[model samples]
Target chain A: MYLAKIYVTYKPSILDPQGVVIKSALERLDYQGIESVTQGKYFQVQLSGADEAAVAKEVEAFVEALLINHNTETYTYDLTEI
Target chain B: MYLAKIYVTYKPSILDPQGVVIKSALERLDYQGIESVTQGKYFQVQLSGADEAAVAKEVEAFVEALLINHNTETYTYDLTEI
Candidate 1:
């Protein structure tokens, strides 16, 4: 088995309103020195596979096909044998 | 400056409906070798601080205070100089 830790985040060019709101909230709550915050999705996927390469390919395919909005987001993953 | 990469995940005892939905979607799409899926939150936070230790302390504080539900969620973070 293999475990893929995937992160899907907004493209750098895109503005993240949710992040801005969180930052503002922190400020309001008296948190200091907070420059900025970017929020994203994180997934841990377990797969039954024979090898790392094969599992990685499957993860990539599924991530590109279903996990992210191509226009505004991008994804990265790390696959580890389990 | 420091960059804190934080992840907030539901405790193992909590049911993740979103992850189950995603797994079902993938199965419907005919992706094979499926096992399980767990989803969580990721954050990239830029903080102004004198050193890593101090910034890490701040990150922990804010994460506990605002970013997660202590009863159902837990968080981890990596702090790096930027």
Candidate 2:
């Protein structure tokens, strides 16, 4: 099987309110030295049979259509046979 | 500076509706070989002054309090000097 680990995050252009909140919370914790915090979505997909290229193509389409908002977020992924 | 990459995922015991939805969509696309799909949250945190160990410790507490639902999810992280 192939395991695809995916990360989907807000584009640098997008404002991340959740990240802001978390940063504020860290400030409250006295955890200094935090420059920025960005939040994102992750997925672990198990595929039964596919070459890396095919899997990558399908994953891109899947992520583009469902996993992320094309206007606001961007994604990247890695796949390993398991 | 330090970069913390964190992943928070659902426990196996819990049902993942979004994952299910994605799997079904993949099926609809005639994208074969997908056995299972699981989804979670990811975070990229930029820290300025703390060493890796101290950052890891504070990150744990931060994630526990705000990032993951401790009862239903689990988390792991990696910190790199940047």
TM-score leader: 1
Ten-residue stretch with the least lDDT total in model 2 chain B: B49-58
Chain B TM-scores of the candidates: 0.95, 0.93
Q: Runs in model 2 with CA error above 4 Å?
A: none
Q: Write the per-residue lDDT of candidate 2 for residues A6-48, one digit (tens) a residue.
A: 9999999999999999899889887777799999999999987
Using Cα atoms, each model's DockQ against the true complex is: 0.87, 0.83
Q: Tell me the native contact fraction for each prediction.
A: 0.92, 0.93
What tens digits encode model 1's per-residue C-alpha lDDT throughout B1-82? 8899998889999999999999999999999988999999999999998877778888888999899999999888888888
lDDT of 2: 0.87
Q: Tell me the spans in candidate 1 whose CA falls farther than 4 Å from its real position.
A: none
lDDT (Cα, 0-100) at A70 in candidate 2: 84
Per-residue lDDT of candidate 2, residues B1-82 (tens digit): 8899999999989998989988898889887788999888999999876577887887787778778887889989988999
